[model samples]
Target: MGSLMHLIPVTDPADPRLAAYTSIREKDLTSGHGGRFIVEGKVTLETLLTRSRFAVESLFLAESRLAPLADLLAKVPADVPVYTAPQDIMDQVAGFPMHRGVLACGLKGDIPLPGEFISEDKPRSGPLLLLSDISNHDNTGACFRNAAAFGAGGLLLDERCCDPLYRKAIRVSSGASLFLPYAHGGTGLDMVNAVLNAGYTVWAMTPRAEAQPMQSLPVPDKLAILLGAEGPGLPDALIAAAEPVRIPMSAGFDSINVATAGAIALAHVFGEKQG
Candidate 1:
């Protein structure tokens, strides 16, 4: 079904109505500074539309690209303005090539704390991803995608983690961040305590010798997989607090990219439960 939105034609790149779409990369959107964030590409936009919590403030698309998105556009509400501009004008407003030709500005809701994010009902069932100081947007986004792909219940982030709603991160996540339930709150240990209280078995990933190998680690009924920033891994104290586990590899190569490692861990935990 096609939506009956108000299709507003945009001729000038500097129009005031287009403020949210202007210089997206240079401005702050993730902190809810402007109460809005940019979402690009068809996949991300589609995901946002389906997820009810995220409200679409407006949409911008290259004139030539509108026809292809007719069905999806029809799903948008009539009150929302769908702005169409020439490909060149979009590039001017974005200050970069808008190759995908489709973009959207979505309003972000208030962020909940870690304790509020974890559900009390059936808390000891699915996997949960607990991220610590994962500063890089790409890695953070990738983890969200992984969490969604593997059916992890939700995500909890420490204070040092980057906003997953950042434009590049959302793009990298292919829109998974927009749909995945996540909250940023407290310190690393605080998040751990919240998950443990919610009935999850906390497992921290590390490359240390004392850590159990992934092959030997049992998949708990309700698991919280802890991951940290790439180079430093988890804090020594945090590792000691949780059951530390390592993905077995050749002796000379003990580490992997944090995103890759997260996917592997999620796969093991989920695969084991299913088996």
Candidate 2:
């Protein structure tokens, strides 16, 4: 927990102490200092501060919103400086309206590689969501939310997937992105092979007619549900390497959003297990 003494008030948007909060959009695209990422909204800030793996560098909050977070702030480490500014100053610093007025910057923990994440000793008895080329932040976050909701063991993301810690992603996920364990590494094919070697049945999600219906598919003791990018779906070669499955839809519709598909698949997989 943090004390009120840790709080520092800043009226100047350009103050060096507040640099971490400056031009957030541009910084998000270009900054790479110490694996740092932004946590937005009160829910996400709470989630960020609670996790041991993540270390807070600084917290920049709108002055008006500061008192509401006293309990949450008490949990923050004393060494982490907390900065408060008026709404106009925060808006000036972030170059945005700063509606939620809750922002914090923190460093990412040492993330495990895909192989390390799915070790040989760990038996896979539950479902894992495997993502490939899922570039959209919202979809990635939504998938994380769905995975957590359905009691997935973890997530395996291919190299092409966007960082789940992105501000929009975190906001969309409602902070589930921080709670779920995930590994990002290798090509989509590499992930498929690694999970297969780890005793997981990799089920590739596609909208093809030949694919097995998700509801009827047998639930393996260990399963990995593979989702592709937004429009193109999974690569054909990758799909060929695994058991292809699909969510049945109406006659004209070809498919649904990847995140929606993930939710449906996760529900079916977890539901069958509980049944």
Candidate 1 is scored at a TM of: 0.95
Please give each candidate's TM-score. 0.95, 0.94
Q: What residue pairs clash in candidate 2, if any at all?
A: 1-74, 1-75, 2-74
C-alpha lDDT values of all predictions:
0.86, 0.86
Model 1, 240: alpha-carbon shift in Å? 2.3
- Which segments of model 2 are wrong by more than 4 Å? 29-31, 120-125
How far is 259's C-alpha from truth in model 2 (Å)?
0.1
lDDT by residue (tens digit), candidate 2, 239-273: 99899998989999977899999999999988888
Cα displacement (Å) at residue 139, model 1: 0.6
Q: What is the lDDT of residue 163 in candidate 2?
A: 88
- The alpha-carbon lDDT assigned to residue 242 of candidate 2 equals 94
